[model samples]
Target: MTQQPLEPGQAPAEHPDAVPLYGPRYRENPAEIFSELRRTHGPVVPVLLEGDVFAWLVIGYRELHELMGDPQLFARDSRIWNQWPNIPPDWPLMTFVAYQPSILFGEGPDHQRRVDAMSGALSEVDQFELRARCEEVADALIDGFAGSGEAELMTQYVYSIPVMTVAWMMGISTTEIDGVARDAVAALDGGEGAPAAYGRLAATMQNLLAAKRAEPGPDVTSRMLAHPVALTDEELVPDLLLVALGGQEPTALWIGNTLHLMLTDDRFSLTLSGGRQSVGQALNEVLWENAPVQAGLGRWATRDTQLGGRHIQAGDALLLGLAGANADPYVRPTSGPPANNAHLSFAHGSHGCPHPAPEIAEVIARTAVEVLLDRIPDVILAVPAEELTWRPSFQLRGLLSLPVKFSPVPATRS
Candidate 1:
C-alpha cells in the first residue's frame, strides 16, 4: 500500500490557534496538540495522520493507561501494519521478531510465553556479565573522543553503545558488527528517511540465524533458537531488527537527551550522581520530559468505542502521547520533583518494552556520564538549549547536535 502524505509540507495550517492545530504534513509537536486538546476536546481528540486516516490522539495519562490495559479492545498486532500503507514489502523487518512477542509487542498466550522466555534470560548472572562487557565498550568509545572537547555525542558515543551491546548479544563478532550496526541504524529510516536499512538488517539477521543454527552459542539469539516455539529466520529477522532499532536508536537519543537536560537544569545535575535512587529519578524525569520516542505504542481500535468523548471507530489507528500523558497534570499529583510522575517512555501496559539489556544499558549510560565528569567536569553548552537542532521526527525526537565547551582535564587525570 502506498502511504498517504499525512502532513505534506509539515508547516502550520491557515486556521490559526482557534481551529484545530494543523501541520502541513506529519505531526510537528504532537505534544502541543494533546496539550491544546486537553483544554478544548477533553483528553482524547479526533486526529488525522498524514491527513488521511482518522485516528484518536490520546493526550491524558489516565485515558492512555486504560486503553493500553485491554489488548483486545486496543490491539497492537497485524492491524497496525494495515493502517500504514507506506510500509512496502521491501521494508526491513524489525531487528527482532515483535509479532511472536518478546516483551515489547506480543499478545494473548503467545505474549505470555515470550515474556517468560525473556524473563529467564534476564537473570542476575547474565546481567552482570553484560555489564562488564558494556563498561569496556563505553570506556573505549568515550575515551577516543574525550580529547576533542566537543563531540557529536549521539553519532559518536550514544548510538555506538547500544548497537555494539545488542550486536554482541546476538553473537555477531566485533569486527563485523560495526558494518552491521551501521546498516541496522539505516533500516529505521522510514518515509523521508532511508528505507533500505531495514532490508539490510533483515539480511544480516538471516545470515546470523543460519550460522547460529549450525553451531549455537551462548548469546541471546542462541537462546532464542532453543525456544520450544522457535521462529524461522524469515519470520524472526524483521522483528529482531525492530527490537534492534527500538533498542538502539531510541536508547542513543535518551542518553544524549539526558546529558543535555542535566547540563541545562541544576536540579537534574545535582541528583544525577546520588546513587541509583537519585540517578533513577533523574532518568525518569528525562524519559518523561524528553523521550526518544514521541508517539505512544500504536493501537488499532477493534470496535467502535467512545474515548475521552471522541467517537473512535473500529479500524482507526490511535497515536497515544506517551510524553504528554506523563506530564499531564490531571493524571498524577507531582509534588516533590518532576521525576515523580509515572512515565510512559518505555510505553506501558501490554506492549511496554521490557528493560531488556537493562544492566548493559545502565552501565553504558553511567559510563558516559563518568567519562564526561572525568574528562571535562565543568562542561557547559556553547549554545542556548532552544538553539539546539532537534531532528525533525515524529516517531523519535532527539537533538541532532549539542555543542558544549570546557577546559580539558589535567594530563594525569586524562
Candidate 2:
C-alpha cells in the first residue's frame, strides 16, 4: 500500500509496509530494523503494536524532540484519546499506555503538581549516598558469586543492585524488596496476569504509603507524603510505582548493557581498562545505541495533525522512538564520540523523567560497574554476544541473561 494522506478522525490504513513493533523480530536487533524503517519510510513510520493496533513510531531526532516538547498538541493524558474506549484491556501495551493516576499519565497543572511532589522528594536524595549504597549492594551481590567464578550478571548483580538500592532508598524493608521488585517487573512487562502484578505492586505501595503516613521516615516515600501538596493514597500509589520502576529498571539495564559492551566490544574493553574512552563514554554510547526504554510511552494527539509528513488523527497514539532517534542519520554524527550528552534516553520536554537526575543515574551505574571490575578485573563473557537474549517487551530493552566467567575469589564482604 502507498503512503496516502489520511483524514481527520480516520485511523491510518494498515499499509503492506506496516512494521510489527513487538515480537521476536523487534526484540532482537531492533536498531537495524528501526534504522531501515527510518531510511525507507521516513521518521514517522506507522507500526502494528499488536493485533489490529497501530500507531505512528517517531524515529527522527528533530521530529521526536518537537513532538515531545509540545504537550498541548501531543498529550500524555490517554483519557483524551478517542480510540481509548475501543482498545481492549488485554492489549499488550495497555500496561504502559492505559490511564493511571500517576504523574507520567497527567498533563498541564495536574502534571506539574505530581512533578512537584516527586521532584521535592527526590531533591533531598544525595547522589553520593546513593552511589555508595549501590556499591555496597554490588559488593554484596558479587560476594554471592565470588567463589563460583561463573555467574549471570543480570540476576546476580546488575538487576539486584538497582532494585535493592531503590527499595532501600524508598524505606522498604530488605525482607520485602525481592517481592516488590518481581511484581514491579511483571507489571512493567505487560503480559499474562499483568493486572494482578500491577495490583500487587499497588498494594505494596499502598502499604508503604500507610507506613510513611503513620511513621514518616527519611526515605522518598515519607518525603513525598510530607510534601506540601499532600498526595492522596490513590495518587501516591501510582507515583511511587512510577518512581520505583523508573529509578530501578532503566538503571539496571544501563549497568548490564554497559557491562555487556565492555565484555564484547574492544573499544569498551580498552575504555574500562584505562584506554582512550571512559566509563561515562561507554554509558552514553550504550544510551545512544541501546536505550533501556527503547521506545517511550505513547502520547495521544489532541487534534488532527501532520508530523513528519504523516497525518495523525485526534486520539491517535504517537510513540517516541528514543533509540531510533538517537541513531537517526540526520542528528547522529557519522564518526567520533558524542560531542555532548544530548541523547533523549531520559526523554525531553515537560513530561520527561523527573526524579534521580541523569548525572546521579550515571553515577550509580558507573560506580556499580567500577566496583565490580575492581573486584573481578578479568571477567569475560561465558556465552558469545549473539547468544545473549533480550527480554521480549515493546517498551523495555534488556537482556534476559548475561553470563560471564572470571577467576574465583573469596567473598570479601560480610
Give, for candidate 2, the lowest lDDT window spanning 10 residues.
Answer: 1-10
lDDT of each structure? 0.62, 0.82
lDDT top scorer: 2
Model 2 accuracy (lDDT, Cα) = 0.82
lDDT of 1: 0.62
- The candidate 1 region of ten consecutive residues with least summed lDDT is 11-20
Write the residue-wise lDDT of candidate 1 on 160-202 in tens digits: 8878877777787777677766775564433433545555666
| lDDT tens per residue, model 2, 1-414 | 123334423445455567777777767888898878988999999886766566789989999999999999999888766655456777666777778888888888888998999888888988878888988888888999999989999988887888898898789988989997788778778777777888887888999888888998889999989899988899999999988888788888999988888888986675554532367777888898888888966798888889998887787788989988988878778795475778889999998878555666787788888888888877899988899998877678889999999999888865
TM-score of 1: 0.81
Report the Cα lDDT for residue 350, model 1.
56
Candidate 1: stretches off by over 4 Å: 1-33, 80-106, 122-125, 268-278, 334-338, 355-360, 409-414
